[model samples]
Target: MNDQGQGITVVSLLLAGLLLYGGAGWLLDSWLGTRLFTPFGLILGSALSIYVIVKKMGGVKS
Candidate 1:
């Protein structure tokens, strides 16, 4: 993929990770009555997204 394609892929993955994990965290917080899950979810999501981005882009050369 080109640079623009890579950028779009990374952005989409990050956004999807954030929404999916963060939403799960929000639901967990609501169910468990805790305040820490949301931030945890966001951090986890970001980390996972970065991991995915690196893994996906690792095989490609410039």
Candidate 2:
């Protein structure tokens, strides 16, 4: 369906944004020898993964 294609595009964009934003921050913190960014990376990755899983499971039925 047309909407399913759109969903894929949107999800891809979200994933890219999450990686560039959160991953960059995590890398910076890691370089500085701070562990705080590790948790942030995990949280960001988990939250985005959950969102995509829910979205794919017809959670958007409206």
For residues 1-62, what per-residue lDDT tens digits would candidate 1 score against the true structure?
A: 88899999999999999998998999999999999899999889989999999999977486
Q: List TM-scores for all candidates, in order.
A: 0.90, 0.49
- Predicted structure 1: lDDT: 0.92
* Stretch of 10 with least lDDT, candidate 1: 53-62
Off by over 4 Å in 1: 59-62
Which runs in model 2 stand beyond 4 Å of their true positions? 35-62
**Residue 10 in candidate 1 has what lDDT?**
93
The positional error of residue 22 in candidate 2, measured at the CA in angstroms, is 1.1
- lDDT of each residue in 1-62, candidate 2, tens digit only: 47788678668757875686578768979799887876677677757765765576544565
lDDT of 2 at 52: 66
Best lDDT among the predictions, by candidate number: 1
Which pairs clash (backbone N, Cα, C closer than 3 Å) in model 2? none
* Top-scoring candidate (TM-score): 1
Q: TM-score of the candidate numbered 1?
A: 0.90
Q: Which ten residues in a row have the lowest lDDT in candidate 2?
A: 53-62
